[model samples]
Target chain A: MAEKKVYEKTLGVMPDVISGFCPGCMHGTVHKLVGEVVQELGMLDKLVRVEGVGCCGLGQQFVSHDVIIAAHGRACAVATGVKRCSPESLVYTYQGDGDLASIGLDETVSAANRGENFTVIFINNGIYGMTGGQMAPTTLIGMKATTAPFGRKVEEHGYPMHVCELLSQLKTPQFLVRTAVDTPQNVIKTRKYIKQAFQNQIDGKGFSLVEVVTSCPTNWGYTAKEALTFLREKMFEEFPLGVYRDKDKEEA
Target chain B: MAERVFMKGCEAIAEAGVRAGCRFFAGYPITPQNEIPEYFARRMPEVGGVFVQGESEVASVNMLYGAAATGTPAMSSSSSCGISLYSEGVSYCASARLPVVYVNVQRGGPGIGAIQPAQQDYLQATKASGNGGFRMIVLAPATVQECVDMVYEAFELAQRDNNPVLVLTDGVIGTMMEPVVLPPMKTDEDIKAMKAKFADKACTGHEPCKQHFCFPGSVGTGQEIANKEAEKMYATWDKDVRVEKYLTDDAEIIFAAYGISARISRAVVKQLRAEGIKAGMIRPITVSPFPYEAFSSLDFNQVKGILDVEMSIPAQMRWDIDHAVQGRCPINECRRSGGQLLTNDQVLEGARQLIKEVL
Candidate 1:
């Protein structure tokens, strides 16, 4: 009898090691997508991850690849180092919002502005998860955070940072997409876009960043199911999901 | 011996780095060290290397941090305030055991004190303490020629220990023009050989190297053990402690100095000896693993006083000297600060006063 297989774990996921991400977090989904993409592209042996600081760095426990954790927000600069020296190595930076948008904005902006040939898997949850629900740079307007006890105010905390839009202003990045994994369909799309981003690097295209709009259920004060609803209802409204930059399509 | 060239101190250090197989350099421009990035910007392309003028010192050092992870021979240079920004990246490299060389072409500091030469960063450079109290072997080059030699060898020393090494130079050596015989340039094959050695640890995507390296290395599991190993590593640096004991064996008054301050002390020692004061100098070439041995080994009865000379207000290196001396002899300081260069005449006068009191 032939057994039908519906789901199987990717070998790209480290064997038997539990991730440090909180339960029901979409970080687990994103990590799975990254691993699947690398394995699908046959780049598992050549892939080098520049791990960011913050929750996104939890992939280290689960992803099977050579990685070097960059000091908070410096992953892009580190990826640039690896890519520039070994052009054949498939280099990517897995960064969280605070690491990419706030403290490491200079490094992020510079690496993308230079159009360094690399992939950036940016996980944009609205709050700081590892640090106990502090306000991240991407925290939405009026969203309550530990730093913003009364919720974010226009006069005080400023509006949420639109990372994809901000990076879109630069001309170098070849593929820029905002995708998510809360829904089954969105998870499929995230895999496709991530594959495209990694493909962009494999094709020797310029910078590619797949910003995954995800949920931090633990930090958002919601259960796993409610967080998915929050992603669909609130997160999608503040940060609309779409491909902001596609150099090939624009040229086409 | 490689060919000799008349070059500025900053350019010489850059050339020495390139010749030592450093194919990647990232640094932000600051006083007394701009020539370094400028030289790399001009020179790197010819060697198929990468040179980045980082938007900030933090970014520059982080770039080196990433590049060094792939087993690339990497170096960064900055002056006083700029190096402070590098403290974060330096700490990461030390913990990750990335062998990257750094040069602090120091200028007056303590919150942007001055643009001219000073040694106010003595404690900072030796402390190299970014976070977690990690220490690096800090090499202090006293001359432009020594700057080239020390920076050329620093990459090797850094790789030998699998740790970061700092070459601490000041404005006098960083900007001074001097004739230096450069080390032989490393070939492409040499660089390949150097990188092949780190195959086990580097993020080069080789099949054998499959693990990620996090700071504190063992991540959450074995950090205390890792910290203890780092503590043990510091003990191994005693052999790398470099200090020049100049006529200190039989002197009545000893001058303790480093970098440009040491040069002045050397000239003052000669002038003082000619005047029959029995003055000698002990210059620390490597300031981190400081030559406390120089003071402890001294015949304290013959040494009437230890004069710590520097271009800093409250002599920073005196802490090490005091520890070495163990209160055996009275320690006096001849200091010129706030961008002032210590004059040989001024140091000689200070030595004479010490001689009167001690000798």
Candidate 2:
């Protein structure tokens, strides 16, 4: 038999690079987690990940899970359709804080309340990373983005919204957790929680949410390393970390 | 076979959709159209379908999108305010070329106008209800029977063209209870055939049941894909636009109207014909294609004038009328907005005045 050299570069994974998100954005981290989960669960063939507008909008770039980009803040609703239409496939959404927590709060809360069998991966960077770092609902106290350059004060801006805590209180959500990737320890924890959230949906448990506390180094005016420190020191204090609700436990 | 039963227009639409093989109904309750979801809530389960009262119109339309993408007949109904909320999903459906039947029972609106019948949504339904170069096959159902008939035809057209179809009715038509005879419900085999043909082109990959020499890709090359789709869509739409002409054969003046406005025009037509004033009606059944040939083919030299009757200020239907006539016929408009219906007497008065001014 003739010897043939197997190509090493061409293998199972995302493209070498893509134009979906800007550099130093946490969308890449979230996308990686989502793609990894789809692969691990052997659901890449039976998955449809709906994307929304913002930094993480064009999920088609990295999400090899038969991705479709919906209108702004409509990922959850679109995923609802995908999951309902094909209950066999595992449906998920990769959304940003502005996409889910701000403009799409109704869909998020309602889908959770309906206990829709799907997974939601929410990234809270506390700013609109796509539209030039505008102030977002998840923006931490005293944080200054483009819209809140004077510093987000409680009197004028209201308190930073903790979506995980708020959604955990709702009666329908089966799994809700808040984790961060500010450090190596939290990064590992975020991955574990994200995998579990996807697993719950695959098991037809119900609506599962994994809110990852992430960072935008360019938007936050910090080095990539320094951005991680800020997320751990400041963002962690306000948002906290750990599971807020798990219906699977209640059932047990 | 003509049978009779007293049912609300909205209820007729729901029942007709059920008969048309729709197994998924998702919608939010809005005034003048709440009966649709309520009916579905009661009857959808009996047919072994899923009925979801979506949290909002946005979610409802999205749910429709999801269900329809699965190759099943899925439908959603809402009024003008709620339909506006569904624009995002409409655009998504349009871009994806998914077949979904959307029922828009319109009320007055530039912004939350009122819960009353109006033709204010003519432009939104026909022109650009959503984004992209998209045109929905708008079906204007003037009578309660039409509300029943159009719902079935809308899904049929939706599946045929693999595009969304809107049943554009008004608050009166949606809320009014009248006699209607619905056709026999579609069989599972019929629905299965449609589901196989109209499901998303990319979803389940390619076909396994080709009789002839099989070729890769059902739609062919990516470069020629959109043009081919456009050509197929226009060809299909050519046969889909339907209109009805009453007393137009020997009329000096013709009234172009649709939906509840068309119902008012009918009474005016009857009174004008009795008075020998020769007023007729050309009711557009499909508002998106707009039945341009029906108006353009008429002998404009013999026809003196056209009055576009609607219930919205500034006459939205006048645009389509003028486009059809192409400056050959004189056009006038009679309309009222802000949740008010244009009464029969008002239309008669306008038709009489137009006769005096033009003839």
Candidate 3:
């Protein structure tokens, strides 16, 4: 008799393959969660992802869905086109903080305001990881990035942006939430939010976004364990994790 | 025969796009071309199509990228500054080999110079549309009827070559109205069949396909190979070069023009002929595959000189004329800029001056 298999491949994900992200990078974990939710929801066949630039763009190689890579900062606009052309297909965009909140802010806000029927998974890591740890739009105050060698100052570098709160002011978005992947419980919660966002799209509710506050260990100069600790203690102090808006619950 | 209707140039082009089976249109409002998106917004729903007024020209072109990647016929329209914003997405479409159509009802510009008609973007459109030094099929229509015809033909050529096509009209023709015989509307079945032919390459998310519909940066040597293939495709476009020749069989003076400038040149050519000047006009209908053969095949022994007419100062299209003529005859520029229109009298006077100097 063969030895009992301890693990099986997640549906809609490549089997036993390593992603190109750094060792402590949370992009792989987020990609796994997205794959698991897409598989659990039975949308593997109908899922189309518009991949953004940077480490977030590497999700295409780890997932088994048809992915169209968008130019840096244009993922939401690209997703809008894909969704409008094929309304029956499930569409989503995976973007980084730099791609989503900085360069692509107009596309993000406009798509949310217009209530485009799709999902956006925005990974907010507070620093530009692929471009060598530069300051990102979501970088916290006093954070030390390559661009901010002396730590971010309020006079020069401005404060971190709460994207969920910024977008919740619009009345059209169906769901807006901020979660993290630093802990097992928070990862589970992040999965729930991701699932809800996709379900909202499937239910034809409206635009939904799940902003995942992740850690960049290489950029942060911390080990994997220290990155989780910093996320829990320091990052959470600035970006408290919770649902900012839920139109479905409000309507109910 | 389809019934003729008096329509604005922009509206007629929009209708022709719909009839050509373009079901997706994404555009941002700009001078002289806003009527295009406005018309699509009103007509797309009736034809079971999708229309989006994007946040900006940047978003509009990327939206076309997404729709076109699905192998659906998609289009966008803008003026000068907006086209500048769209340059990146246009280059992406060319590199990815996605056949999309964009119309530039040009305005004067280095940066929002004026809202009125100008042909200053000729170099930008034909020479360097975007980075990576790619080429697009650029069509310049002198009349509203030609606008409708070229727009209809542009969709077919875009799909046939799997490349981006630009309908490079100007503010004058974009706002002008005339009677045009519209093409027959493509049936729903026809559109479906056309899309089905691209099913193998389309990213409809129905099955797992190996082709990555993304930027070509990570493909290593594959990027160079794709560039070579694109270069070959561009070489084959020589047969598709089109121009309207008016009595160049035996002439001593020739006028080279396109778009609104061509209209003035046509009148100038007729006036010169009536005065027994042996003058003619060569109007380029397709500007990108710049009709070099038209100049190369001219009888140099009888030709006096060529007057390059345009609505741009410093003469943009004159460069192509210079390259084509290759010192066979002296090339002179008859041009106006900054929202100024070239008159027939001005062109005739310029032609006579060149004729007197050369002969």
Candidate 4:
């Protein structure tokens, strides 16, 4: 009997380099999904990934692709430049909650509004991971962070940003979805969303974004197992997973 | 030779950039330089290029960064306050070695002081364009014709150094209309070949998707070494120093000026020469890698004094002149600030006063 192959290495990520993400962090998982999408699409040679400043910038270290590390909060604008110049090359920006929802909000909205032919993978972790857990724009009202030691207040910090909901209001973006990677079942769903975002760009369908509601175990102060549990119980309650917009399926 | 056509400096600059194979431009609306983006919007599509009126000056420069990284000649144009916004992205471009070009049609400012015209951004242009001790080759053009030529050459200089270059004109030069013989527009093939040269390091997807990249914003030996390498590269820019040394061979008083101020200074030189005072002018076309050698080489014994004529209060270019003159001759300035244009008679009187003090 011939041995069956169940798993194989993907060259989308560099071989043998350990990721520096803290344990229980979803950056590695999301990165793995992106790497899988890159390989599955046969775009390992022509993918230009623009990584925003923050934990997402670590994509430069292990992503085996043409990479541009954009200045803090400027990845969307940078990706716009790359996509406009090399229309044939696949381009995307990887950004975190703070990088996308706060400092980079204008770039995020403008790129999506223009319907730029590219992809955006937004990791909404509710806290600034690389900066050691400052409250992010997407942080829940009662969530505690280094900056909000006593937990966020409704009057002081305001409400969390629902990126999928906010961007869905735009008429241009071809695809917009919210997903998670906290459970094996959700992880499979997350991969599908990521793949669809890539396929949107490949089909020249214009801007597509997948907002992943992830957890930063180090910053959230939880063990890997407990973090997944917390993400399932707490994070899911705030940012429920679903497709926010799909231009292809919408009435033309 | 191309036919000479009368055009505004800003329009000439836009056309020159397109002709030089600059395929991408992203800029925001700013006073005294609005025509630049307006022209690009109408022209880029015709030339098979792109134009983006970005969300802000900050986003526009970052867009230039992304476009430039792919080996495409990219540019952005702005005025005083807008260039301040461009500083961060400009610094990033320098560190990343992404060749990019920008134009600053300066208007007066400590804080949007006035919109007409002023040379107050001289120090800002040459000394501290941005953080991280990064430097750019700043070009100052006095006329619409020269503006066209400098803009044409700026892309090549940027590509050669793999660094950012600035065309420092003024509201006077940017808005004023003059006859310019434009360079031939670059063909589609020429632009493609230019980008192909940067294919190796450019972020364009080449199969295998290989890249080793890092941003320098930390305290480490790697950044230190990169800074040192930048310093060595800046040192070689001395060869690219451009200054218009006019009749300094037998002059008693020399006028040091640039841009519109330099244009005025030339008339002052002739007016003084008519009166037999033997005045000459040294104009810096390339303000950064400033032609200090032009000043240091002057026979100080024969030269009575050097007058700094400018449109700023403290004479911003004085810093470079001080370094060049090195106390050999007294450096006094005839300057008008806050959008005030210097008159030829006013500068001639200042030159006479300087000559009296030195003699």
**Candidate 3 wrong stretches, greater than 4 Å:** A1-6, B208-217
Model 4 chain A: worst 10 consecutive residues (lDDT sum) = A8-17
Q: Which regions of candidate 2 are displaced past 4 Å?
A: A1-24, A182-184, A250-252, B1-4, B198-232
DockQ of 4: 0.68
Per-residue lDDT of model 4, residues B44-95, tens digit only: 9998899998999989999999999888899999999999999999999999
Query: Ranking under DockQ, best-scoring first?
Result: 4, 1, 3, 2
True interface contacts reproduced, per candidate: 0.69, 0.27, 0.56, 0.77
Candidate 4 to truth, TM = 0.97
Displacement of the residue A233 alpha carbon in candidate 1, Å: 1.4
Worst 10 residues of 1 chain B by lDDT: B207-216
TM-score of 3: 0.98
Model 1 lDDT at residue A37: 86
Measured against the true structure, the TM-scores of the candidates, in listed sequence, are: 0.97, 0.90, 0.98, 0.97
CA-lDDT, candidates in order: 0.87, 0.80, 0.89, 0.89
- Name the candidate that leads on DockQ: 4
Specify the poorest-scoring 10-residue window by lDDT in model 4 chain B: B209-218
What's every prediction's RMSD, in angstroms? 1.6, 4.8, 1.5, 1.6
TM-score, candidate 4, first chain: 0.97
Q: What is the interface RMSD of each candidate, in Å?
A: 2.3, 8.3, 2.1, 1.9
